[model samples]
Every structure is written in C-alpha cells, then in structure tokens.
Target: MEFASRYLLRPSRICFPLLLLLAAAAAAAAAVAVPPVAQQEQDRIGRLPGQPHVDFAQYAGYVTVNASAGRALFYWLVEAPASAQPAPLVLWLNGGPGCSSVAYGASEELGPFRIHSDGMTLYLNPHAWNRVANVLFLDSPAGVGFSYTNTSSDLITSGDHRTAVDAYNFLVNWFERFPQYKQREFYIAGESYAGHYVPQLSQLVYEKNIGIQNPAINFKGFLVGNAVTDDYHDYVGTFEYWWTHGLISDSTYRILRIHCDNEVSEHPSGACMQALETADAEMGNIDPYSIYTLPCNDTGSLRRNLRGHYPWMSRAYDPCTERYSKMYYNHPEVQKALHANTTGIPYLWDTCSDTVGNNWGDAPKSMLPIYQELISAGLKIWVFSGDTDSVVPLTATRYSIDALKLKTVKNWYPWYDHGKVGGWSQIYGGLTLVTVTGAGHEVPLHRPRQALILFRHFLKNKPMPES
Candidate 1:
C-alpha cells in the first residue's frame, strides 16, 4: 500500500471581513458565541463536492506541531449528528504505519460517507462510527497523507517514540483549538500497525496525566483490530495461518519457520527475505487484505475514464473500494472540498505512503510491555480481529494475547448481531478479545454492521451480546 500526497492551493490566506462573516454565520447557526478556538481553527470550510446533505458539521484542517520545521498534521473531524447530543471523541487511525486515515478510515471504512465508484460523488454510511462518537481521522508523522514537514530529514526518519510524542503534541494543541472538547472523554482506536500507535500514544497520555491536578483531556481506554502486537507471534501465527488455510505449501511453511522464526529485526536478513518471497509466490495474486474477496484489476487509465458515471457498485461487499478512493481523493474538486493538498504537495493522494513505510525508523519487537502497563493502570482495553485477515489473522492475535498470561474471566462464546452469530469473544483479566466472523484485515470495511456493534459495546464498556 503506497500513497502520495496531492498538490493544491493552500488555504492560509483569507480576508478578515470574510472571516468575521463566517464566524457570525456559525455563531448564529449554533446559537452561541463563536469562540476564538472555533474562529482560528475553522478556516477551512466548504461542503464536499457531491456530498449528501447531512445534519452533522464536518471540518478538515491542519494542526501545527512544529512551526520552526514546518511540520503539521492533517485531520478531518466528523461530529456526530446534532440530534445525537454532544458525543465523546474517538480518534480513528488506520494501520499501514503510514496510511491516510482520511482516505481509508473516513472515506472507506467507518466514516459518515463512502465514495461512489464514479469518484465524483458520495453515499451515506448508515453505520459510521460518528453515529456513536465524534470521529477524528488524522494523517500523522509529518509525511503521511496531507501531513508534511519542510524538513526532509523528518519525513525520511520516523519511529514509534517520535510518532507518539508528536501525536500527543497534536492532541494538546488540537484541544487548544477546540476548547469545547478539552474535557470530553477521549478514546483512541485504530487497526493494523496502529496496534503500536494507539497503545504508545495512550501510554503517553496516561503518563502526562500523572500528578496533574486536572487533565484537560479525559483519556479513556483503546481498541485495536487485526493489530500487529508482537513480532515473534505475528510471524509465527502468519505462517501457521497461511499453511492451515492452504495458501502456502508445507515445505514453504517449514522453510519460513526455520529461517524467519523470531526474526523481529527492523530489517530482515537476506535468507528471511528470500523465504518470504517464496511464500508470497505461493500465495499468488489474491487480495491479501481480504483473501476470499476479488482483487481490483482496474488500471489507472480505466479508473480515469469512469469519471462521472457509477463505475461499478457491487450489490455485496466491494473489495475494489481502495481503487475508488484513490480516484476520489485525487480529483481536484474533491481535494478543494476537503481543503486537502493545500500546500501543493508534489504527489497525488494515495491510500498508503511509500515514503513513510520505507523510512520507518524504529519498530519495537513487542508492545506487550506497554499493554501490561496500560492494563495495570485500570484503563479499559479491547482487542478485536477479523478472522479472514491473513496478514494479521485471528491466530496471530490469539498467540499475542496468550503471551500476556492473563486469566480468562469468561469462556469463549459466540456473540450475536441481527440474531445471527457475528463473531466470538472472551474476556480476560484486563482485556477482551473479539473476532468478527468472515471479516478481513479492515474489519469495519468488511463488516460495517458488526463492526459498529463491536464499537458500541467497546464504548459502553460492556461485553458483546451473546444469545
């Protein structure tokens, strides 16, 4: 998954009179004084082209984390429908370690709308998480998505620790920009590599709250799905999953076990790489994200030609949504609507960033220590896996959780949604593990209804319903 940033006019300059007029309109609409926080941060405002009419107020803009270095992170905040009342804030991140949460999380997954195949319009997501929480999707680490830094070194080198610190800074400043939500309950949720991001950022938030008489941000628990936790278990479980699912040959699996076992280094050895290549060859051209789903064979040219017409909308699940996202985000009108690509970034918008992925500086072998620390602090923790995600399968999550050595508070049981088995769940001493049946790497994208049920349960701090 490789992503490129887009280039468009920066929206930093606006006349004072226009700003005053906009503030007056906002204040009158909400029937409240327009605070400075709202005035300063609400510079970028416009309805997305072809977006459906909605009652919720949506915003997109940048939060400067480092002024001297020209570093800023892009964010899209989709507030819950006004009728739902003020909702808790949930920061949604997508994994890739370098992916665009706006493109994936907001546009494709649990956001308010899904991009139509025509790449020029949108459709309402009936089960968007914003229905339950104010969802904030961020493109992080200064180089991912619309986030950027004038310092080239910053983009070429990023790691877990720096990312956590920067994210904390972003939140603190973001709160300053949106004072209304400063004291609101906050929860972090993400998938894939965000297994590292969510826990790491939560730990920072928890540590910063210590000894403070009153913390501005009411930090709460976190939830991750198909997350990458431990390297050893992840690799072992992945190989085992491939073999068991008949995606790899026995000999290839055996070779991977011997060569890549416990190979958690940031850079694998030549032998391990060779073994992985062999395994991938056996896996073929199937969609690794959702093994059972069809892969998108549409080329760039084909996508461009389907500009204004409904390209292809599947009656069921469409695995080709990623292709549509790329098309949608790259459209000049769409970028202008979202106030993205404002700096005229040199590349086209992409789902995942190649620069960030390739330059990822540090990846801890395991996040178990941080998990243990957070769990001991009495924070709510929930881990979910989409059973069909071969990249980080349920087996991998099970193995990682097993390493925690926590007592099972409840025996495993099937959880129901729509009067049918949605998945299975088990409660541990400090955490809960859940599985979304027939889902893949991106749980919400694969099982929107079930994912919403899982999210609602997580927010309520309750177990999934069993019938």
Candidate 2:
C-alpha cells in the first residue's frame, strides 16, 4: 500500500552574539595573526571568478512525512534518471542546528542553483550532485521548517540520539511514500554539525534493522561533509588549528594552551567559552578558514559580516540593512509551507535559540565507540571532510577516524576528475574518508563537482575516481 504524498522530512546550536565588539576585535586579530586557509586553497584551485552564474530549473516536488504525533516534514527530491537503476538514495541534512536544508542545500549547496534576489528566479549550478544519483533534502526535527510535532514536549532538547531516532523513523516512514525506492541503496549525508547526526542516525537505523528483522533501511553507508564527530579531539584541534593558521596570537595561543585546550572534559566551562570568544573575536567577520579578507566593520557591518562569512551560502547581498530573514519569514509561500509558530516568537523560526528546547549541547566525548557498535551491527560508514573549514577542520575528522583504528583495506589516494585532483579517499574497515580539495563548511556550495563525485561513489559503490 502506498503512503500519502506528504511523507516528509529532517543541527547543532549556534548562538549569534548580540554585539559585534568581540567579533570585531576577533576579526582584526585574525587578520594580523592568521594566514587564511580558505584563501590559500582557493588560490590553489581557483573559483568561477566574478559573480557565479547559476541557471535554475524546477526539478521534482515535495514529500510530506507524517508522524504519529501529527507533525510533518517537507522534503524535496532531486531525482535521478530512469536509467539509474536501483539508484542510490541520499538523504541530505543541513546543520544550523536549526538552518533550513532548502536554503542551503537547494540554493547555495548542490541542489541545482542559486535563488535570485527577487526570489522568483534561479541560476543553474554547473556542479549539482544529482547528476550522479537521487538526492533528498529534508528539514527535520519538528519546528525546523514545515516539519512539526503535535506535542510541545516534542520540542524539547534535541541531541545526537533523539535526532538519530527521528531521522531513522523518517526513513522507515518515507519508504512508505516512495515505495519504488525501497530497494535502492540508501545513504545519509550532510555537513557541519551533521557530522554528529549522520553517524548517530546510521547507528540507530542499523540497530533497528537487527531488532525488527527487516532489510528495508537498505542502509548502504553514511557520508558527512566536514562533520563534527568526536568531542575531545575536535575541540582541542580547534585551538591547535587556530594557532597553526595564525588566527590565535602566540600569547593568546599560550593562554589557550594552558587554560582552554587542556581543560576539556565531558562538559566545558566559562574558561572554554572565553577561549573560543578570544578566537572568535580574533577571527571576526573574516573567516579564519578562508583567504578572503573582509572589509572592516562599518555601522552596518554585522549584516556585511554575515554575508561575507557565508558569501556562497547566504542569499542576502546586504543581510543587515535589508533584513532578508524578516522579509523571508513574511513571504506568503514561505509562511504557507512552513510550520513555525511566530505568534509572539521573535523569529518565524529560531535560527539559534536556547529556549526552543533543542538541547543538543555538544559533541560527544568519543564517537569511536559508536563506530564499534555500527560495525558490529554490519553498517557501512563514510566520513568526508571539506579541507578548508576552520569551524570543524579536516584535521579533527582525521583524528576522530584515526581513533577508530580500523584495519586499512585501502590506503590514502587522491581522487581525480578530468585529470585534475578533486579529492582524496581512504577506505578502512566498514568506513571511508574522502577529503575534497576546495571545500569549506558546505561542500555543495564550495566544491559541488567533488561533492557530486563523492555521492556518486557512495551510492553506486563505484570505485573512487582515479587521480
């Protein structure tokens, strides 16, 4: 029996500072102290230059995933061709902890193109991932977008485990909507804090497969873009990477070294926050990871900073003065499609809020233990990194996987396309790590070609591209 067409969809927590004073201070320090990793990489590979031109074409429609609790999720399917038999199914989740997948995935990342300033137009991206396989972009966990829940309790703190459960449940129910793809090889992929979501969900689904005695999950593997997995090394690596990149002044580095990095435990303290604040203040609007030096703050600099930091990902030409979000939440189509309760709520949707009850506090101390459980349960895992992301640097990913100590079936090798180096892939027991050359936090936005290549290999079980 087929399910209704409404079968749907799918962070991390990010707190924006009320004042940019610290951030401004951080920016100046970042400029003077650090060498931009993002710019250096961009220099190495180069970009489209000038304004990137995107051509937009409407593809497929949305699916509503109905939950027992009465909430629903809206999902967009980037379909593969009819000839793409038993095609790989990819469920793409974007991390805000509260950001919309449609905003990033469809617009900035790999869906197809950029949505124009008018909101009615689009430009096609030459590097969309769907060229290789079917892609599903989901806004998840009730209250994120169109996804909603019946119970207020449902809106409580979100973490790795709860998110995993909801996502796994979404998969089970989503199959009811698109039954045709039940047998298709399925993969869960995303970026940023999705590093935590993908693996945790993969682990949950794999466990349920054993408990339910069903093969429906069809879970071939899990893929993450610059994902945040292990808490310990990732947090520590942030400072080390900052110092190495010159974002942290030597004195500040020494300060962080003695106080911040060393003090990491199960739960962090004000000292850690202070250290991060120091780093954040130093980096300011200019991305510590990228080579792009931002103009100093003017009166309207906060909005400028927002746009500059997320140039490829944000739609706003001027985020501060225009207030794209205020206008966005007010759009009739957006309002009609979204389930956010704006009644007295400051934001139609809270991009970052402590009050929303999604208490996904921090990354776990050790993610390697989760790996043991997944492998023991017969799951395939893939960890991919965008080498230029300072937030969740590639080195952190390496350290996380290295802790797994998996037997190396394949050594590190560069992946090539059109005789150009695209990325590198390393295959170990039940897992793979692919690092894209010119990607930042969001691979689709920065390195769509490489992202597509990685997705194709994941879904089709195709061999890694030759260098």
- Candidate 1 stretches with Cα past 4 Å from truth are 1-36, 40-44, 298-316, 343-347
lDDT of 2 by residue, 180-297 (tens): 6776778888877676677777777776776554487687667777766766677566657768877678876776667655435443456655765676677656543332323223
The candidate that achieves the highest lDDT relative to the unseen native structure: 1
Q: State the weakest 10-residue window (summed lDDT) of model 1.
A: 2-11
lDDT of each: 0.78, 0.58
TM-score of each predicted structure versus truth: 0.87, 0.73
**Tens digits of per-residue lDDT for model 1 on 1-467?**
11010100011111111122232223223333445477445644468888889888888876767766667788899998888767899998876667779878888789999988788788899889999899999988777776766666676687888888889999998888888898798999999888889999999999999998779889988999999898889888888998999999999889778877754345466777777777778888766777776556633444444323322222435666877787887787776677666533334667766666666777788899999999999999999999887887889899999999999999899999868899999999999999998788888888899999999999988999997
Q: How far is candidate 2 from the true structure (C-alpha RMSD, Å)?
A: 13.6
> How does residue 199 of candidate 2 score in lDDT?
74
